[model samples]
Target: MRFLRNALLALAACAFAARPAMAQEILRDTESEALLQDMAAPIVKAAGFQPGAIDIVLLNDPSINAFVAGGQAIYIHSGLIETADNANEVQGVIAHEMGHITGGHVIRSSEGMADASRISILSLLLGAVAVAAGSAEAGMGAIMAGQRAALGKFLAFTRVQESSADAAGAKFLSDAGISGRGSIAFFDKLMGEEIRHGISQDDDEQFVRTHPMTGDRMSRLRDVYSKDPAWNTPVDPQLQSRFVLMKAKLEGYLATPEATLRDYPLSRDDEAALYARAYAYHKDARMDQAIAETDALLSREPDNPYFLELKGQVLLESGRPDEALESLRRANELTRNSPLIAAIFGHALIATEDPAHYDEARQVLRAAVARDRDNPFAWYQLGVVYAAQGDEPRARLASAEQQILSREYARALMSARAAESALPKDTPDWLRAQDIRMQAEAELERSRDRR
Candidate 1:
């Protein structure tokens, strides 16, 4: 889990330095990302996006919501994944969010707001005219009526957009040759939640809500899906299997150990159960039990990089860095040096406290950051390597990298300046340090302007 504040949001935070800004919590896991990417690729392409053009980001929030904030990204809450029965269900949600992107709804939302504002302003004018005529009660009533009307108008616009996205999603699924059964099933789950919460599906409530009634959406989607040729198609078995494991993995990581044990007991020795129990045991600080569970997984699939990564993580966190290195090194190799896993491997190498390992750590950490510069943790580890080697200039440059990502623009600017002064001019390191200094200065200026 990491906190990612957008650069613009970070600047805004700096502008309001008197109050603490809420950071957006992101869950970045290589295994989960790979699965999500594979699941979203076809839907993305079907929605007219190139492969890798659309990103599916997982948020740490436990709310059953998936939305497109802007651009070509879909943010899926952890709760949505937890609630979903299969990958197909998530795919259905992704397709729907893609509809919002393709329709430019986020950009067009200003139109709805403007339309509502016009009604509100006109109503205020009318109310003022009544007030001037000495009818105080009538003026108040007019003002209140205008507010309600504006709200209703805005909500109606949103509802229309929602319905349009639903139709677009259905078409995307059809074009992708994916089954819509999972989509309908997921809607049924949402409908159940609405009933459980006693949320009325009456006409009046529907008029005020931003979305149409859950039941109405399901009904409309069902009709459209039923007529599609892919309606009866089965989900890919491999994808379904991965989803089950992913869900279990999330449960183990997020749930209390007691709850995880209750849900997946020792008696259940399936791969998913083992994966869950491994994490649960690790969280409970039961080293022997954690290792045993991990060993069970390794026995089943020795070459599995994710399992190896997990084993390495457990070992490293338990202060057995030496024992962790072999597993982590192999995992990194297996994944072709995946940035996230390699970062861990680099950290483990540093944890060994062996000066002999510092060179290898430096190499690994450099490569990790090269592949994924957004990873502050990797940059931190790389800084550790540079500092350990007595390379002050490079160390400051690394610190600048980590600080910039962490939104510490002031500190980053200082570090970058120090690094640029010490490093030889025209060198790559010197150039990167200069870049950071300029970037930090620009962000600081933006923050000042906002203030």
Candidate 2:
């Protein structure tokens, strides 16, 4: 389990950060990602941005943080979702982040340089903290102690940007027909925490450090929202229900088994509780109990793709690859061929270790990788299929693709070079091999320079 966790952490690094040294670990959960999209899409459109213009990135960090970096992308911490009571609170945050993007705050800042690697989460957070501290010097002092006042001014510019974002975000929420109450309440709660922590002078929490809490900002939010009719509107009950279910699933996977069980005892007996308990049991390696709980979920919503996906995932991990196929296949069908499910299904096929399944595994995995090019696991499985078929060059190319996605540049370089030498010259595969070789070499050079 630890090995799997570590490998997942390694693969979590996103391809968006193409710079070899600037990889950001991302969590890829279809349900969570889909929910985030659903919440953000309307607010994003309301903010006068094209739907395809912005991208949402989920981080596995437990910290309650979210920021915009790399221009259009929003990086949200898992802790934010787990801690928020409802979807509106998170949607509110997304709306604000979108404001940053829409207000041109992200692109206008020095952090949002033309180079993707320069647009970092660290810079965004530091800018926010600087704004909160209300001192250009204090903000720069934390990182660059001896810089001139100009650098301080540069960092301090974030205050105006933050204020603009707050106003813009409020308008977006109203326009989207969502109550800004969630945004206001969220800030109110954060301010309360800041006060409690300030009383002791032990320093502020990470959130407080990054997002400066001010009475004026809070008042502005309240004033703007109070005037809007949507301020009194309640969140959609259906959205609220989905939010609860998503939170329970996250808690189950992220929290300890005991903690999950304690929070979601059998007597609770709700679908969300059952889902949480199922994950807890899976983590504890109680296969029968886990499957039984999953069955309970499936029995309630027989055609639900997520429940089927979970059951298939557990079965696959528990060494019942054949049994995993049915559920995963059904899930793939129901979900309109989700790349994640397809990838997992391909993995099950490969797990059987039968040469007869290799051809089908290769086809399925190829389709999965085609859909999600950043999926290193799918690429790895495709390489396995290729190797099983005695196609060394294709295997090496796929292996190189996997290593590149995993940010193992040295290994990728070697594999790409091997593929390059063995494949037909000037062909698509050879050209791809050349591209990998160049990227990997450049990455390796950067690493050496860092040393």
Candidate 3:
């Protein structure tokens, strides 16, 4: 246990590698991922981590945080997005996290650690939190986050190791055509936050708790950037516009209607700004205003897939089922793979009573499932679609499976035990298979008791 603890800490601090206990099923959808991919393209090529294959999971936490849990995965907090004022900053964060994976930090840590169990448990805690919060699809599995206070109770890294990660990460930024200035700037922001909070380390995020902060480190980062050619590179227009627009849309989604309109208005310079306003009005429940703004944006841009997507969402939310279907179908045709848009279309299909919806829903869901197979929510929805048209046996199985996947622990345990009867005992993936089975059981039990 001690080995695991010390190792994970050292790895996180020294090499920035993560030997995660279990991988979270969190995944990014096609539309939201487009921008992330655009931003990451430079460094991913430089870093040599299967460029398009690497997954970036967006965590739901509002705190300023980011990390690479698995060797190939990058987890960015939704709060990180809200906090980053520009695309460069977000890219810098990703580059730093990616550095950890490239460095083999976790494996290095494990090689030197003492207590394997303690390390594994601590890692499990962090992994679980990230999985629930950062999952791409709506329903993240299980809930243990209320006990975050207990998350870092095991081996954690030294200040020296953290410093190494930062130094290494800065290099990744430079190699990726981004100025390490973003790292410096981000640390600067956090340092300001620390000062504002009186450097209350006790109140810092879980990631910060393990990876402490210092002003000298920030200064060092700035010095590194002084020599980086990317420091002067201008931020791309498309990236900048998307950042603002995404932030605006997310704000509108979470904040109150008045607040939404206040932050994101229609009379902006870019097409994205217009899309943001359209979304704000949609959420504000002003149908006419939303449609008018969207149509105007369409008139200007003529064929923005994102705008079309927003139009679909607005139409659906505002009770225009048929129109929503048309818009979403068009949006899907344009992009060919958007889970959010597909999900919306599924709902719209129900309203349209179109016979084609049954198969398309399955097809869209299949695509969605391909991207995020562990998404019990998508699976559950698929089960419903199957059940709605009278496939009781398939519906029951999917429901049972989904219920298990969603944390029906006891039931999943039973199901796994049942599966065990016919399984080969020596299979290498046996443990992994059983673990998932147990998680499903746990979810089932919890849901039944509602605790």
The C-alpha local distance difference test score for the whole of candidate 1 amounts to 0.87
Task: Give the per-residue lDDT digits (tens) of candidate 1, residues 346-431.
Answer: 99999999999999999999999988999999999999989999999999999999999999999999999999999999999999
Cα error, candidate 3, residue 274 (Å): 3.1
Go through the candidates in order and give each one's C-alpha lDDT: 0.87, 0.78, 0.65
**Candidate topping lDDT:** 1
Candidate 3, residue 70: the lDDT equals 52
**For residues 124-243, could you state the per-residue lDDT of candidate 2 as single tens digits?**
457559868797766655434322222333333555567778888888998999998888777766666657777332324222222334555788789889999998899878788888
The residue ranges of model 1 lying beyond 4 angstroms of the native Cα positions read: 1-22, 445-451
In candidate 1, which residue pairs clash? none
Clashes of each: 0, 0, 34
RMSD values, in order shown: 5.4, 9.2, 11.8
Provide the lowest-lDDT 10-residue window in model 2.
Answer: 12-21
Which ranges in model 2 have alpha carbons more than 4 Å from their true place?
1-24, 111-155, 199-212
RMSD versus native structure for model 1 = 5.4
Instruction: Indicate the worst ten consecutive residues by lDDT in candidate 1.
Output: 13-22
